[model samples]
Target: MSKVDFDEYVKEYDELLNKNLSFFSKDDSYFCRYKADLIKQYSSKNPKRILEFGAGIGRNIPFIKNAYPESEIYAYDVSQKSLDYLEQKHPYAKVIREFKGFENFFDLVFCSVVYHHIPVDERQKATNDIFSSLISGGEFFVFEHNPLNPVTRKLVERCPYDEDAVLLSPGEMKNTAKAAGFNDFSVKYYLYFPPALKISFLEKFLRTLPLGGQYMLKAIKR
Candidate 1:
């Protein structure tokens, strides 16, 4: 199997996602909103410009837009069809179909479960590109599936669109950020509860646990 052709999955993406990964929040928009919310939570200030790296069909666009309604919002993706569809749905965002280093342009860059799709050999360049795209104090927020979790591993192995996914551990994620010149890094494991579990309150107390279904890494450019 090769990398996923996201264009083919654009229309059915939401249905497929919720059907499989609603364990995060048991909400129709959990996967998308969850990440967008995380970005907002960690942001030090209201960023003047925001970019969604690998935006794919713009499922996360609306939430990000709402979070930074006064800020400029931009989305980038390799799939032209997905970009086109996303643009139609979200004319507010400037959609980039091709890759160009924004070059110290974004105040914040957010990626949600995207790096696993990059070829293992190219992840270094991707990180470096992101470093170049952010300002001196810009922040990068990354969310990735936890390879250490059996259920997350099973989900990735079975996901059709995840054919190219190479799950990186928290340490690998940290090293990639460090090599890219990102400092003041903070890593936390989350999604510790299953679907509709009332123990959501306990998640904050368990950030150090590695058994969570997913993990988030926050890197700041200094």
Candidate 2:
């Protein structure tokens, strides 16, 4: 297969994402809220700076902003168009095309559902970039589709923009983090029930199950 042109792919996805932003709204689903909660729990107290890697259209902006209210938030993505939309929607965030001058600049970095779209060979470089973006002992929260979940598989198959997506298992994510030179990290499985079937009382119990639609890898930079 030919190498996927991520720059072009991102631009196309930016347009699609803008129109579908409501689907990712935090208030619309427990999944979004739960992911945000995880981010809030793992990040440092009063983080000085935060970066949201692959923050397409800034869907996680509200959650990150609320989580680190006192911190300077930066948004990074491959698409300028997506960053443009994110900037207009979130004027306070500093949008960047690359992590060029940001080595060791952030206390926390949140990456959500963006890695599966990355080509396998390029993931190492992406992981290393994220590792470099954070200061020593900083936190990196990575969320991705759980390949073990049937629903997740179906959703990825049905989504038009996800044509190139290759879901990563929790083990794959953990290995990527470890290969990036991070020895301190833990993987957590979450979101067992979809919004329509979600029962609030059972969420805590269900979170222990590894059959959720997605999983998160929380790594600390050394």
Candidate 3:
């Protein structure tokens, strides 16, 4: 979308995400629990630094900061309004420009539901930038929407969502990571239902299966 729409969306995204967070938090859906676990798994408890790209509104800051209270947390986003909100919420985080030369600088770098906002063509360049920012052997974690989900595909296209959003398949994500100078890349599916759905048992069962509606891809810097 245009800059105006991006700004407007940022102004309103909290309401939308807050609703989902509330719904998902009621029963600790596997996705919710799984996301936290994934972050912990990638983040070293005694990390000296952390970087989060596309960290709109600092949604993951609280948990990340809690997990590594002594580490410095740096974030970057293109939206000024979103960064404003992030600064308000997480004064401790240092906001940078786009993801450039982030490689080998952080012990763990992550993004949540954010990579989709990257254009399909430029996604690789973005991944390269993310890779450049990481420290050797540092892990990268991404919580992304699954493109194979018919329901999600319909809604994302139907809405006046960010124009840059491009859902990618599991294999596509792995390839992008591999092309970005990463090794040991892998994608793990999770979140088996629509955000509005309210069935934890069903979510858990769905996640246990081979296919799910979302995923968390973990990779290491080579």
User: lDDT of each structure?
Assistant: 0.86, 0.77, 0.71
Selected candidate, larger lDDT, 1 vs 2 = 1
lDDT digits (tens) for residues 1-222 of candidate 2 = 353344554446645544443343324434556777887765555689888888887778877787678889899988677787889989999998866866888888888988987889899999998888888988889999889988778767776677788888888888998999876777777766544554644756665578877788888887
Task: Name the better of 1 and 3 by lDDT.
Answer: 1
Residue 191: error of model 2 in Å?
Answer: 1.6
Runs in model 2 deviating more than 4 A are 1-30, 196-198
Candidate 1: C-alpha RMSD after superposition:
1.5
What number of backbone clashes does candidate 1 have, counting pairs of residues 3 or more apart or in separate chains?
0
Candidate that would win on lDDT: 1
Off by over 4 Å in 3: 1-5, 18-34, 42-45, 101-103, 193-210
The global Cα lDDT (0 to 1) of model 1 is: 0.86
Report the alpha-carbon TM-score of model 3 versus the true structure: 0.81
lDDT of each residue in 1-222, candidate 1, tens digit only:
487888899888887887777656567676677677778877896899898889988888999988779999888988888899989999999987766847999899888889999888889998999999999999999999999999999988888888888999989988999999999988778887754777766877888888888899999999
**Ten-residue stretch with the least lDDT total in model 1:** 22-31
Residue 159 of model 3, lDDT score: 51
Query: What value does the lDDT take at residue 117 in candidate 1?
Result: 93
Candidate 1 pairs with clashing backbones: none
